[model samples]
Each structure stands twice: as structure tokens, then as C-alpha cells.
Target: MRLSQFFLPTLKENPAEAQIASHRLMLRAGMIRQQSAGIYTWLPLGLRVLRKVEAIVREEQNRAGVVELLMPTIQSADLWRESGRYDDYGKEMLRITDRHERELLYGPTNEEMLTDIVRTFVKSYKQLPLNLYHIQWKFRDEVRPRFGVMRGREFLMKDAYSFDLDEASARVSYNKQFLAYLRTYARLGLKAIPMKADTGPIGGDLSHEFIILAETGESQVFCDKDWLDLDVLDKAPKSAEELQSFVDWATGFYAATEEKHDPNAVPIPADRLHSARGIEVGHIFYFGEKYSKPMNATITLADGSTTPMHMGSYGVGVSRLLGAIIEASHDEAGIIWPEAVAPYHVGIITMKAGDAASDAKAQEIYAALTAKGIDVLYDDRDERAGVKFADLDLIGLPWQIIIGPRGLEKGVVEVKNRRTGQRDELSVTDALARVGA
Candidate 1:
């Protein structure tokens, strides 16, 4: 994409309201704009990153045997009433009313709606052990929404609901989601420790909150430092037994949110006990019949007995991840995007855009990169060399290719690694080869 044609309205000064580094950089980099207190309109650059994150989440979910299906943002309040949570879910729920006077709401979560849907069509044990997921917008009307998308009132979420015949089967389904979340965060270049958490409004005895440690985080977390080196991706899925082994290994670590922290519990050696602020990016819960029983989502068993299906809900904050990622990986210059979720793999900057030789060389490299199926954001705007370089750094593409009259005269272009701030001057072919294009 060409910068001149892109709708990036970058700002020179930070917005006073943005209190965190990710929020500040997002605004200054022209990734998003606030339309209201906690609502934002994602701009072109931000949307690209958001979709990339969503795609990773979707791919991992599919790999874990979860099918995808979108659910509506607005849901009838009747579903909540049927599940006996209408009165219990408090002011955080964004209640609304249609012109016809029917009760409606922007769903904060989909447990009630999904349960109602399952009860309507799924009968008997034949359709048991099903997982349905969606990527959709949700609203919670947080009383004091802050930290940009990290705590926004309106945000995008990847929510999956699983249904099974009994508690044992439900536990298996929960373990699948548990493993999936581990893989998902790893792919996005984040070390998200799954800590036992309190199930606030989404009542469940078994719950885990996947958190990324950040200085600006809202919650205090304790965990073993060894978790940082454990790699779930290297392990292969064998039987349910093997999968359970991996899950047990991950959960055996000493990790818990402040609410669940126990001083006398098995402690990490004092040197390895990590106490830090962390942001909760994903949460999973096995709620047994929390929604199913109340909503009559039951199936006839092989023994001819009818019983409510056990259910679980897993959630990843798709939008909030943009902020969490920045919080986890960034520097004083700007955001340092991970390669997997970067909007573009490379940023091609023509230091002297008006110079015929520099322009031609940049165009050639851009064409070659594009033909090789690379996502490159070309800075073709007529700006000073320093300005272009600063913008490229701010956007934080993994690699930067700098072309100028001087470099072109030497039959070379400068290639820079964003993460390492290392530069090398190589022939155009060598540069392209280095960038894998």
C-alpha cells in the first residue's frame, strides 16, 4: 500500500487522554481514533493489524477442531432472562430497547444466546461434543473505560462455546480450548501465562485467564519464571491422554491472579517467583450446566434419560490484543510489531522520492516484493528523508528497505532490521533475498 493513498492521519503530539504507551502510539501513528469515551473507529492501518490478529486466532481455533460461525452483536434480552442472568449481570450490560418497546442489548458475552440456539435444534446425544466460535463486536459499557482498546467499552472478541453430554466430556472440550489459547498467544509473539482467575460475572469454578505481563497492566499476577521457556508448539497432539499431559504440565506451574493467590501454596523459589502487573488477553471457563440447564439445552442419553448438556465458554479479546501486544513489545521509538501480526512485513522508504534513480529503484523493489507475495508498505510520499525514516520506525514493520540516490549510485540499497536497529548495504538482489522476497 502507498502512504500517499492511505488514510493515515498521524499526529505530531500525543493525545492528552491516552495514558498508556500503546494507546499513545496508536493515536500518534494514526492507527485508531476515539469516537466516544471508550469506543474507537479503527483506521486503515489499525484494521489491517486487527484482521491479522483475528486470522491467527481463527486458524488456531480451526486447528483445535472448533468450527467458525458469526453471531450477532445485538441479542434479545429474553435469552438472558431464560438463563436467569438478566438481573444478575449488572450495569455493565448495555441494555437497549427497540422502538417497538421490546427489550434488547448489545451482548457482553454469548453464553445465553448460544445456549438457546443449541437447545432449539440440537437434540439427542448424536450432536454432542460440538464447539462453535465467532469473531464479533461486543459492548460492556465499562464505567471507566481507559487504556484505549485494552479496556474499551466496545471491542471485537473471538468467543467459542462448547457443548458436551457430561462433565468428563466437557472437561475434555475445555482442555482443547486451553491448549488452543497457548498456541494462539505463542504465534502472536506473546508469552501469555494462564493463571487461575476469579470468574467474575461468568460464574464457573474452573477458569483461567491468559495474561501478558506489562508495566501498565491493571491486575497483579504471580507465576513461575520457568513458564517463559516452555514451548507448547514443539509438542505434537497424540490422543486425548497426550493432550491432557501437555495441559497438566502447563497448569502445574505456580500461577494465579491476585484474587486466587495463596501465600501457603506451593511457591516458586524466591528467585524465580515473578510478581508483576499483567493484562488479561483471553479467558476460558468450564461452567458445567450454568447456561444449559437454565435454558433447557438437554439431550436424550443412550440410557433414555434426558439431561442438560455441559457447556464452556472461551474468549480472546481480539481488539484488546492490539494494545496488549504493544505493551508487551515496544520501545521508546514506537511499537515493535511481531512479524506474524504486523500489517506489513516490510516498509520500503524512498529517501529521495523525487529523484528519478531512487524512485525507479524503489518501484522495482516494490514490484518484486509484491510479486513474491510480500506485504510491503511503500512510502512514496514526497517528504524529507528524516521524516520518512521516522514514520517507518513508528509503524514498526519488521524490515525497512531504504533507497536513495547515493545507495542507488553504488548499486545497493540499505536494509534495516526494525527489531535490532541493524543496517546493511547490499545489492538489490541480495536485499530482496535477505528479506525472503
Candidate 2:
């Protein structure tokens, strides 16, 4: 994409509303614009990153054997009533009334709706162990929505509902999601630790919150230092017993949110302990019959007896991750996007857009990169070299190719690594191979 043609309205100065690095960089980089308190319109650059994050979530969910389905953002208030939670959900639930005076709501979560759907169609044990997932927008009217998309009232989410005939079978499904989340975060260049968590308002005994440690995070968390090195994917479990073994190992360490933390109950030595502020990026829960039983989502057992299906809920903060990632990855310069989720793999900055030789060389490299299936954002606008460089750093593409009259005269271009801030001059072919590779 050419910058001249692209609608990136990057700001030279930080906006007053931005309180943190992610918020400020997002605004200055022209990735998003706030329309209201805690609400934003993702611009071209931001939307690309958002879609990439959603795609990774979808891929991991599918890899874990979860089927994908779309659910409406607006749900029936009567659906919540079925589970006796409509009024209990409090002011955060955006209640509404249609012209017919029927109660409806912009769903904060989808447990009630999903359970209702399962009860309507799934009838027997043979249909057990089904997992349905969707990537969609959600809203929760926060009383004090702040910190940009980090705590937005409206955002995108990836939610998956799992149904199984019994507690044992349900665990197998839960374990699949556990491992899936590990792979998902790792792919996005985050080390999200799974810590035992309470099922606030959701009502489940078994739950885990995936947290990424960041100085700007809202929640204070305590965990073992070993978690930084431990990869959950390395300990993937295939059966319920194996799953329990892995869970036992994870819980053996000291890790909990403030609500669940016990200062003196930590099992690890003082040296091996660690504490930090963390952002909650994902959560998994096994709420045996919590939604299903209340909603009468029953299935016939092998012996012909009827019982409520055991269920679990898995959620990834699709939109919040953008903020969380920026919080964890950015430097003083700007966002240092992970390679997997970068809007473009490479950015081509032409030092002199009007110079015939420099312009031709940049266009040639851009074409070659695009032809090689690489996404390149070419700054073909007639802007100062310093301005282009700053924008390139702010947007944080993994690699950048700098084309100038001097470099073109030498039969080469300058290649720079955004994260390392390293520059090397190489022939156009060598530069393309290095960045495109």
C-alpha cells in the first residue's frame, strides 16, 4: 500500500486523552481514533492488525478441534432470564427495549445464548464433546471506561463454548482450549501465564486467566518465575488424566490474582517467586452444568437417563490484545509489532519521492516484495526523509528498506531492522532476499 493513497492520519503530538504508551502510540501512529469514551474506530493500519489478531485466534481455535460459528452481538434479555442472570448482571449489561417493548441487550457474554442453542438442537450423548466458537464484537458499558482499547466498553472477542455429556469428557474439551490458548499467545509473541482464577459473576469453580506481565497492566499478579521459561505447549495433554497432570503442575506454583492471593501460602522459595502487574488477555472455565442445567440443556445418557451437559467457556480478548501487545512490546520510539501480526512485513521508505532514480528503485523493490507474497507498505509520498523515518518507526513494521539517491547511486538500498535498530546497505536483490525471507 502506498502512503499517499492510504488514509493514515498520523499525529505529530500525543492526544490529551491518552494515559499510557499503547494509547498514545496508537493515536500518534494513526491506528485508531476515539469516537466517544471507551469507544474507537480502528483506522486502516489498526484494522489490519486487529484482523491479524483475530485470524490467529481463529486458527488456534480450529486447531484445537473447536468448530467456528457466528453469534449475534445483540442477544435477547429473555435469554439471560432463562439462566436467572438478567437483573443480576447489573448496570454493565446494556439493556434495551425494541419497538415491541421486548427486552433485549447487547450481550456482554454469550453463555445463555449458546446454551439455549445447544438445548434446542443437541439431544443425545452422541452429540457430546462439541465445541463452538466465534469471533465477534461485544459491549459492556463500563462505569469508568479508560486506558483506550485496554478497557474499552466495546471491543472484539473470541469466545468458544464447549459441551460434553459428563464432567470427565468435559475436561478433555477444556484441556484442548488450554493448549490452544498457549499456542495462540506464543504465536502473537506474548508470554501469557495461565494462573488459577475465580469465576467472577460467571460462576465456575474451575477457571484460569492468561496474563501477560506489563508495567501498565491493571491487575497485580503473583506467580513463579519459572513460568517465564515454561511453555504450556510443551506439556500438551491428550486425555483427562494427562490434562489433570498438567494442571497439577501449573497450579503447583504460586500464581494468583489479588483476590485469590495468599501472601504466606506461596509454596516456592523467595528466590524463585515473582510478582508483577499483568493484563488479562484470555480466560478458560469449566462450569459443570452452570449454564446448561439452568437453561435445561439436557442430553440422554448411554443408559437412557437424561442429564445436563457439562460445559466450559473460553475467551480471548481479541481487541484488548492490541493494547496488551503494545504495552508489552513497544519502546520509546513506538510499537514494535511481532512478525506474525505485523500489518506489513516490510516498509519501503523512499528518501526522495520526486527523484527519478530513487522513486524507480523503491517501486522496483516494492513490486518484488509484493510478488513474493510479502506485504509491503511503501511510503511513496513526497515527505521529508526524517518524517518518513519517524513514521516507519512509529508503525513498527519488522523490516524497512530505505531508498535514496545516494544508496541508489551505489547500486544498493539500506535495510533496517525495526526491533534491533540495525542498518546495513545491500544490493536491491540482497535487500529483498533479506527482508522478504
Candidate 3:
């Protein structure tokens, strides 16, 4: 993509309303724009990153044996009432009425809708152990929606529901999601610690929130220092018993959110304890029969008796992840995007766009990398070198190839690493091989 042809409306100054690093940088980088309070329109650059995040989430979910099926943003109010949670859900839920005066709502969550779907189609123990997932937009009427997409009223979410015939089998399904969340975060270049959590209105006895450490995080969290060295993807569980054991070992460390923290109850020694602020990017819950029982989502057992299916809910904050990533990975200049989620892998800055030599060299490098299946942002704008440098840093591509008139005359171009601020001058052929590699 060429910068001159791209619709990036980058601002030279920060927006006063942005309170955090991610919000300010996103605005200045022209990634997103506020459509209303707590709502945003994701610009082209932001959408590219978002879609990358979504793809990773989808791949991880599929690897965990969950099937995909999209659900509607608007759900019938009757489903909520049938689950005995209509009025109880409170003001956060946006209640609506169609022209026919039927009650409907923009779903804050899909527990009831999922239960209704399973009950209508699935029957008997043979259909048990099914896990279904979807990535969709959700809305909650937050009284005070601030901190940009971190706490937005409208956001994208990856939600999965698991159904099993009994509690024992349901646990195996729950464990799959538990491990999946950890692997997902790690793949996105995040170190996420799973901590015991309160289920809140979702109403589950067993719950875990996956938190990533960040100075600008909203929640205070405490954990064992060993978590810093722990590699969550070190081992993969292959059996039901192995899954249970892995989950037990993973949760064996002492970790809790501020609301659930109990200093005296911590099992780790004082020296091994580590406390820091964290942002929650994912959560998993095992609320057996919570919705199935109320909604009469029953299945026939092997003995021909009927019982409600044990169920669990797994969620990942798809849109909020951008804020969380920027919060955890940016410096004073701008966002330092992880390569896996970067909008583009490399950026080509043509120092003198109108210069014949400079333009030719930039196009050559850009075409070579693009042909190698790389996403390259070619800055062909007629702008100053300093301006181009600042924009490249602000956008945060992992690699940059700088083609200037002077360097072209020297038979080489400058290569830069955005995260390390490393720059080197090399032949054009060598530079392409390095960045493209």
C-alpha cells in the first residue's frame, strides 16, 4: 500500500479526550476515530490489525476443537426472560422495541441465545460434548465508557459455548478452552497469567481471567514471580486426565485480582510474590447447567433419563486487545506492534519521492517484498525525511527500509528495526533479503 493513496489522517498533536497511550497514539496514527461516546469507527489501518487478531483467535479456537457459527447481534428479549435474567441484567443491556412492539435487545452476551439454539436442535447424549463459537460485535450501555476501546460500549468479541452431558465430561471441555486462551495470548506476543476470578453476572463457580501485565492497566493483580519465566505453551495435554493435571499445574501458582486478593492466604513466600497492574484480555467459565436448566436444554442420557447439559463459556476481548497490546508494548515515540499483529510487516520510506534514483529503488524493494508475500507500506508521499521517519515510527511496522538520495548514490539503503531502534546501511539486494526474511 502506498501512503499517498492510503486514507491515513494522522494528527500532529494528541486529542485531548484520549487519556491513555493507546488512545492517543491510535488517534495520531490514524487507526481509529470516535463515532460517539464509547463507540468508534475502525479506520483502515486499525481494521487490518483487528482482522489479524481475529484470525489468530479463530485458529486457536479451531485447534481446540471448537466449531464456528455466527450469531445475531440483536436477540429476542424473550430468550433473556426465559433464562430468568431479563430485568435482572439491568441498564447495561440496551432494551428495544420493533415496529410490532416486540421486545428485542442488542445482546451483551450470548449465553441464553446459545442455549436456545442447542435445545432446539441437539438431543440425546450422542450430541453431547459439542463446542460452538462465534466472533461478533456486542454492545453494553456503560454509564461511563472511557479509556478508548479498553472499555468501549461497542466492541468485537470471540465467544464460545461448550455443551456436555455431565459435569465430568464438561471439565475436559473447560480445560481445552483454558489451555487455548493461554496459547492464544502467547501467539499474540503477550505473557498472560491465568488467575481465579469472580464470574460476576455470568454466574459461574469456576472461572479464570487471563491478564497481561502493563503499566497502564486498569486492574491491580498479584502473582508468583515465577510466572515471568513460565512458558505456557511448553507442553500440550493430550488426554482427559492430562488436561486436568495441566490445568491444575497451571493454576497452582498464586495469582489473584485486587478484588479477590487475600495476602495472608497466599501460598507463595513473600520474596516470590509479584504484584503489578494488568489488563484482562480473555476469560473462561464453567457454569454447568446455569442456562441449560433454566432454558430446558435437556438431553437423553444413555439410560434414557433426561438431564440438562453441563455448559461453559469462553470469551476473548477481540477489539479491546488492541488497547491492551499498545498499553503493554509501546514506548515514548509510539506503538511497537508485535509482528504477528502488525498491520504491515515492513514499511518502505522514500526520502525523496520525486528523485528518480530514490523512487526507483523504493519501488524495487517494495515490489520484491510484496512479491515474497510480505505486507509493505510504501511511503511515496512528497514529504520531508523527518516527517516520514516520525510517521514510520508512529505506525510501528516491525521492519523499515529507508531509501534516500544520498544512500542510493552510495549503492545502498538504510534498514531499521522499529523495536530496537537499530539501523544499518547495506546493499539494496542484502537489505531486501534481510527485511524480507
- By TM-score rank, best first, the candidates go 3, 1, 2
What is candidate 2's lDDT per residue for 101-161, written digit by digit as tens?
9989999999999998889999999987899999999999999999999999999999999
Q: Using Cα atoms with residue i matched to residue i, what is each candidate's TM-score against the true structure?
A: 0.97, 0.96, 0.98
- Considering only N, C-alpha and C atoms within 3 Å, which residue pairs clash in candidate 3? none
Choose 1 or 3, whichever is better by lDDT: 3
Cα RMSDs, all models: 1.3, 1.6, 1.2
lDDT of each: 0.90, 0.89, 0.92
In candidate 3, stretches whose alpha carbon ends up further than 4 angstroms from where it belongs are 238-241
The pairs that clash in candidate 1 are none
lDDT of 3 by residue, 193-278 (tens): 98888899898799999999999888899999997788768865767668888999999988888887898788999999999999
The superposed Cα distance between candidate 1 and the true structure at residue 19, in angstroms, equals 0.1
